[model samples]
Target: MTGISYRRPSSYSRLIGVGGARGDRIVPNGDLAEALERDDEWIRRRTGIITRRHASREVLVQHLAEQAARAALDASGVPAGEMDVIIVSTVTWMKMTPGLAPLLGARVGASPSAAAYDVNAGCAGFCYAIAQADAMIRSGLARHALVVGAEKLVDFTDPTERTISFILGDGAGAVVLGPSDTPGVGPTVWGSDGRKGDAIRTTHDWLEYKYADDFRDVPWPTAEQDGPTIFRWATSVAPHFAAQAIEAAGLTPADIDVFIPHQANLRIVETMAHTLGLREDAVIARDVIDTGNTSGASVPLAMERLLREGTVHGGQTALLFGFGAGLCYASQVVELPDAVGGDGEYHADAPTAMSESEEIGAGE
Candidate 1:
């Protein structure tokens, strides 16, 4: 048999646009004070979060993802029909079947033939999805791709759980990537430590609830984490990998114009920046102060905030890093895009919404 042929790869992939969407409800530390039995100051001292957004019970993961994706598409001035691929990174979609990507693509009016799927790398998901999209584009498998990170952590959080309840939030962020004449997206440096997998995970597995001796008495699965463990791992690993990512791009920390780490905590962000020896002029993202830890959506959301506020401008070089859950982490360097959208506004008229009781299957 003749050998299979392949399409020529593109020279590079670059971000064309960025967007974000936050939940409708703003939840302050004071709101969670009674449950966590801690004062607002204590919460702020620990996580650097004064407030966070929580989607109304009526809102679903797909709604946040679709809204963010549409904003990115609109900002890029690229109709959804031109998209060749769509990747959604989320852990709170609830349903296992009928992956959210296809639905999001359809909602955004992407071409029927576009390849779409979901990614579950926890907090590092968005970066992972970006790496994947960059690869696909470089290999000529896609001409334009949409990468989104969305989460509704409220659905998986227990208000009384002091370790995580005060830290979680809901939101989504997205970016559009297309071919570039020069290197715009840099090499990705990523890895995971599964030995610490239990450091951040749901309290119960689906099988445990399904096979429970008393179904009604079974606790619904909610997220929990070993705060100290995650904090320690993230702080130590971030600096190393961030440097590797920068080096992989043939640059040094001084060359970076901005720093956007996972908005996990303010202390972690500061610690990593210092240890990495970044220039004093590098603008560091502190979106966590108001957005809390948005899991996979953190990086893009923070990036969007910086761009929208004029703190960082287009063509600036940024170092992006994300670490959490799976103990997984990913880092890369990229040239910032000019188009930015989504101003933390919640549109009630958004098309996608689902009730809390809905039980949809994966890939349905």
Candidate 2:
């Protein structure tokens, strides 16, 4: 109560200058949608979601991931072949080996040595990935890093786990980080807690039996949720961590221009906004109602929504909150530039040299 020490974030960090996003169509009719039909007033009063996006199984995680990555690559005017490293920040991946990072690099024809791999930090993963890549640039480890937050939750979602099904969606958002002379463009504040990992976690396993010629097996996928505990924990935990981050930068919550909490639940977002003394529209929130919780992909997905809809203009301070799974959470204020390379000029439809689906894998 007196003083909470949020481990200080690395100082050798720079702002991620360019941001990009792309997602699929989202429709309602899961759990909460029906609950809302039960009583519109009740649903609105309890949670703030009117609708959420649901990705089709046909749209693989790799497709959306590549689309989002290409958008950032196009918007930044930095060729995919020029990236220093491409970090895929996700808990859900296209495959177990090569981490999908290499697969992305290979498909795009980035330098053969273009470092690529996957890293997970629950829903807060994107922030963690950005912080890591920023440090690389600020530390002279690399000239540029592509951080992508992508997830095809459809791959792991257990429809039976209706508690989260109504609140989750699939999509990807990407940003390119490089050096900048701007003041607030780089410095960051971040932290994590592994103790409450189970507060919001997903688990999977494989099963088999020995039967020689007459062998048989039944492998199953199981996703669980302790709904109430997660909701209450998020409301309390997220704000505390967010405050800790803003405080670390010698700034108060008032200094932030936008608050982007992982679109977990409408109530959770509203509670955090109220606690932080922020206006409803001050923070960029959407896509979740249509996307559901794309796990760690949520924040960037929301950022992509703002970047495209024109809600988030250049040079705005954004306070992003990512909490879930791992019972883990972290926060950072990104001093995002209004345009690529601080160019005040804005482009509605940035162009990519080659479309992912069109260019990759010759035959669809």
Candidate 3:
């Protein structure tokens, strides 16, 4: 057998915020205010989700994306203007004209030349984006990379689709990536079974599937889902793929300091942690009591929460896994350094600008 080695980091992204939104969305409950036909207890037992916050579709996706980017930029000390690339990882992007990155750049004041775009691999969008950023950095094609995961699924799911509606919320999470020779996060792993891609889809109408519009044609504005099947899929594949990633990093399940599985459902989370033989007391869990499944935003949002509270302190290992929609999946291990700030670490909502500088370059 070969030896197992670990590469620890001295610093890491200082995570902050669940987009610092204005107010919390109400969780569906029995006889509670705006409770769906389904009661809270019933909803919780089945999906392990008691509540989730839905973003106002009226608010532009760029606003939430920029807010999260500001938080990551502030925490990482990376300037937005210097950012070489901005990847807005989401399936629910705004209108087709500007795409996500350009709009995000305008919102945050980044260099006009910075490359930006969007992607869709369902909830695995961030993981897909992470791999893209890593490859670009490793290949010397890019320097500072800003990764943001934002979703507004509530915009798509009408109230009738309770199976899908109550389970999703809207928010964004961001991280700044730079070239680093120093071992930082982990060598990530990506896997997919497109064979089941159609099992979960965002549109049912042929016109919708084609992503056509009245004036022109746009894709990915809204989404449709098959919730029950996807839930079963999450319970099964997420942990196994996460294990594959940990093993690739030369670490055992026990070595992981925290499990930041995507904040889709509590039952899946509870099951996956158990299957992986990890502790249930989470160092990095989505404060999902109300924010339900932000899909693409789940993992990074959880990372923000954990880092903000020092739940995942300096010098600990975290494993993050995400899977959904495309039947797509991804997992990775991250080493956390101190997120030391004066007033402890962070607050749920912040008032001023983020602390990241205006320049960008990978610091490996």
Candidate 4:
């Protein structure tokens, strides 16, 4: 029998462009203060969040994802038609069928044949997706891929719930990956602690909520978490994983120019940074202060903010890590993208010229 042939793999993969999109509504602590019966100062002291974005009911998850994806594609100068894969990592898509990836691909004008799918690894989703995209490119499954982390946590957050409601926000961030001559995305260090999965999760599953005899009394499935438990786990585990990622990349704390961890909480970010003992000049993302905790979208959002603010530049070495929910986490070292697209403004009323078929296909 003749030997089977395989597609030629690329030497490596690297992020080519980056983009971010946030909801239009700016929700301040005062807006949620009455519901939580907590003052803005108290909330600020605890979470370091002054404001967060919450998309209006009319603004669907796909809109944010599309906006981010467009910006990334424009920045990369890689037309959507060239994309071979598109991955969306989100937990609050609110639907079980017709995944967000395909819809986003259609809306963004990616070739219909592109492999599209969704990933739900909780807050670590973006890093997980990036790792997958990198592997796909290196394995010759794809040459150019778009990886997006978008979420509408507001839809699943209960204002009356104090554990994580105020910390939740809605937004999306994305990156374009393509083949590179050398390693631009380093080895990923990832793992999950299923034993502590309950540290952060929804209050109940769909089945429980659907079967409840007292419909009104039964709370809707909403995000909830053991704050203290997650704090301890993240601070302790993040440092180790971050070091492993750096070491895997054949670098050290001194070599990392930026540190973008999951924007879950300011305290967690600070604790992990302190524990890691990175160089004093290393820039740590504090996007959580303004963006709140956007779950899966946090890592890329933080990285985008750093780039937009001119704090970190292209070719700079950075360590990106994310952890939450499923008690899962992923970290990797990467060379920052050279350019970013999109004005970082989300126009809810912006019109699109998508063909009728594309609109219908995207389920818009």
- What is candidate 1's lDDT per residue for 1-364, written digit by digit as tens? 9998988889899999999998889999999999888999999899889999888876677888888888888888889999999999999887778888988888889889999999999999999999999999999999899999999999899999988878988999999999998998999999999999999999987888778898878788898899999888877866898899999999999999999999998988999999999999999999999888999999999998999889999899999998888889999999999999767555878665344334243234
lDDT of 4 by residue, 53-78 (tens): 89887676778888888888998999
Single out the weakest 10-residue window by summed lDDT for candidate 3: 355-364
TM-score versus the correct structure, for each prediction: 0.95, 0.80, 0.80, 0.95
Give the better candidate number (3 or 4) by TM-score.
4
Model 3: residue 45 alpha-carbon error in angstroms: 1.2
How big is the RMSD of model 3?
A: 8.3
List the pairs of residues colliding in candidate 4.
none
Report, for every candidate in turn, its global Cα lDDT versus the true structure: 0.90, 0.65, 0.67, 0.89
**lDDT, candidate 3, 296-348, per-residue tens:** 88877777767766676755788878888768888888665344222212224
Candidate 4 to truth, TM: 0.95
Better of 1 and 2 by TM-score: 1
Residue 77 lDDT, candidate 2, scale 0-100: 74
TM-score of 1: 0.95
